[model samples]
Target: MAEGRSEIRLSPSLRGRIERFLAAAGPALEEFPPLETQKLVSELYVHQMELHLRNEELRRKQVVVQRFLHRQEEIQSEERFRSMAQTAIDAVISTDERGRIISWNQGAQAIFGYQEDEVLDQHLAILFPERYRAACRRKVERRRFSGMVPFPGKAMELHGLRQDGGEFPLELSLSRWEAGANSGYTAIIRDISKRWALTLALEGAAHKWRTTFDAIGDGVFLLNLDYEILQCNHAMSDQVRKPFGEIIGRRCHKVVHRRSSPIDGCPFVRMKKSRRRETLILRRDDCWFKIAVDPILDDDGNLRGGVHVTTDITTMMLAQEALKETLARLKRNMDETVAVLAATAGSRDPYTAGHQHNVAQLACAIAREMGLSPEQFEGIRVIGLLHDIGKVAVPAELLSKPGKLSELEFGIIKSHSLMGYEILKRIEFPWPVALAVLQHHERLDGSGYPGRLPGAEICLEAKIIAVADVVEAMSSHRPYRSSLGIDRALEEIFQGRGVCYDPEIVDACISLFTQKGFSFGQEPFLILSPADETGAAQGGPGPGREPAAVRSEETPVQKGKSAAKKSGGLEGRQ
Candidate 1:
């Protein structure tokens, strides 16, 4: 049966040939081939079994090859992950569920000054300072249980510790991942010391600028293009009589003027339009302010807004006005006093009634013609008005004598200049009015009375007065002589130029009366009293006569000339 089974499994062609042989040698083969056929069939079955075993061994080897390839691929993926972490500029670290650092990359070693081996198995809290470690552990534990991160997927600044026990600022970003059954956290950290320092420096500068802005004494307002107040200092708040919060964001005109529109010729508007500085003086509630507006510009040279500074000048303006009023009052008082003194002196002697008045008017004109300063002219005017003030002491007989006086009377009359100096020297005056009075009779050639001061020694005011005195004396009727006339007066000064009178003064006096048509406004008359008629006939002192040293029309000229002639010449009089 087994031989038959083997024959049935043969190829068709072999089976056909075998069947033919079996038919031919059927009887003969039956006896010899039965054992051979069974043996061959059994050997074929054994070879098939060996081949099946080899095939099963090859299938087992193929399974081993597949597993080896899969393991190699996993190792390459791990190598790539390590390469990326090591080369990253930021520190990379992985912590286990307990917050223990399981993996530390080379970047972590560089940033924290630690080796991978040193940080592994250590608590991740070791990267934070002791003060922050407790808080950090609590936060990590909270995240683990609640599946909530305090700063997940976000970078946060925190204090970090280095291997050398130093602390620095760092930015940290955290994330969570699952490694099989264990949950872990990955942290990316970066050193931020330079950036933090820069931020602090900028904050410091801004603080300094804010401090300076508030320190100004003048009211300062920073305004936008719309004239709205954007920022203001304490002074501005005080100026508006409001708090800083209330003043800000309000229009400047509304705050300052209390109106919806700007004031006329608004400096802020002008500054914006012109892109330049503008200034104006404003008065509000009787207070004055000097307001200055300056435009602010951007980097591109476009107008941004304006800065308004208002300075209070009310006190200064009030002080200036008060000073002007005071000066005017003082001038009025001085003029009234001068007029009274001049009238009193003129009243003492009827013969020289308007003598001082005429001298003063001519002296002022001469001074004006000479282009003397107002102060100089004023001094000359006052001196001329009071030139004969000392004549109050002279006897009226000596003052109004129609004939030449005795030597003693002339000496007494000449003392009037010295007396005038003594009376006025003690009074404080802006100019040398007293000195000019004392020196008025002094001639340029050292030829006049009281003191025969030379031209250089005499003041210009005295020189001008002396010339005016001579001209008026000669031009008017004196007690001793009839009017010498204006022509004779002018000729006398012209002849005496550089001798007794200042040459410039003589020229100025001449020019005024000749070219300028100068005149004493009103002429004065002597109202002779009944006592004066008798005293004039007797040529002696009368009831209303002043004391000895009184001035007369002849006192500064004729009497002086008479004394000079008797003593030889003007140079010899003193």
Candidate 2:
């Protein structure tokens, strides 16, 4: 038993020594099997070798994968750069230090109409027109002085030569860079054909506007918010007696009116604040101008300045003022003539003494209500006063009779319109005043007595006077009848609208008398023109007399007596 115990102690120490030796050698021979070891130790060594082999395989695979990923990143970066360069609208070309073409993008192909093969390795001067080649070389030399910025955002107008030898305008921006020890320039060029055309058109429009402003018979100016003269045309300069350059930057009041401050309702100031137009009479030292100011706006509709257009109305206003006296005299003479003529017609029939004068007053009112132009309205007023002047041709005995006229006498009265036309045709007035007299009896639908003119052909002025004439004739007392009320006169016109009178004029007249509460009668004659001297001398009413009678009459003795006095009035008017 003691011998067995000693053997056990020796076995344990020997096993511990064997385990230490295996641990020390395990790392160096991890893949190799230990041939001198026991079978169990050899089996452990084989398992460790298999695990080391698998780890080595996995490390090799990881290294291959990392290399592939780095290469993929480089390819993607190149692709992105290429895409950006291709999409540009301007031509981009790069050249080597020796001035030979290096990289040509698609934009370069489009601008110069040259394929990459045609331009690559060629001189950069090939893209320049012959006329600009020398200039381009000087430009290239100047680039050395400039710090190289990228070839864009710098606009320089230049000429480019296409492959077909045609030349086009271009805007170029250039950059110089170093790549792999080679110096080069990248020129970005854009064709400016469309832009140049638009520029030329804008220049032409500006020139036309300037020409119009300068050559116009009136004055024109551009003003800033402070009312300084920003621009003035030749006419304005002439008016102010100053040179254009001298006038510019000077206050408008100082240059024009010799004043240091603005006047009330200053057009320029009003235009700036309101962004609208303002018109007023501008008085300078010796000139009166109708000046209009309009605001100038930018592309975004921002107010930039004011434009002032001035029309010289001094001469016109002076002429109107000068003619005042002559007009007054003419008016007085016309009143006397109308009264005498109207009274002569009425005197034959006492009951109709104030009929024509009252009609004239009513006709003038109707003309005002119709919104007729000033000239037309004036013509109506005159013609309304003298409308029945031709009735003097009728016999007095028939006119004063307090009974209905025979058909023959009535037929004769109908000739008054034609007679009036013939009587006034020789007088040259600014208006066709005689035409209004003749047409006043005509109708819109061609249904009235006389000329039978239809719509539009019946002048607006005539339509108004016609309605007034009918109303006056019907409302006033006649020798054969009593006075018809205003309502009856209106009903007559209302019934005749669109048939005997213009609907608008009839409606306007109705509105004036019925709705507006305007009344007529007992007013003196508003004479427009004189009667013949032969008619005037026959014991007729004088100026300021009431209206004459409604008569279709004349006396042979009265015609002979008035001939001389009527001739003098005609000569004076002429």
Pairs with steric clashes in candidate 1? 391-550, 391-551, 393-547, 393-548, 394-546, 394-547, 394-548, 394-549, 394-550, 395-547
Model 2 Cα lDDT, one tens digit per residue, 422-534: 77788666666678767777777775557667767877667777778767765665544555456556655665666676776777766555445456753332333433112
lDDT of 1 by residue, 1-574 (tens): 2311221245576557556656776668766566756765575577567656766666788789999998898789879987999899889998987788988888889889998888899988899899887777786776642222344587777789999999999988888888558898898899899999999999999899889888888999999999999999988888889998788999999988888999889999888778899999988889999999999899999998999999999999899899999988987899898888777777877545587878888888888778889988888889888887888777766676555556677788888888888888998889888998888889888867777788899988888888888778766765455665666566567657788887778777765555455666532322344433432122222234322321254543455455334433322111
What is model 2's C-alpha RMSD? 14.8
TM-scores for every candidate against the unseen true structure: 0.60, 0.48
Worst 10 residues of 2 by lDDT: 565-574
lDDT of 2 at 159: 78
| Sliding window of 10 residues with minimal summed lDDT for model 1 | 534-543
Best by TM-score: 1
Compute the lDDT for candidate 1.
0.76
Local lDDT at 464 for model 1: 87
lDDT of 2: 0.67
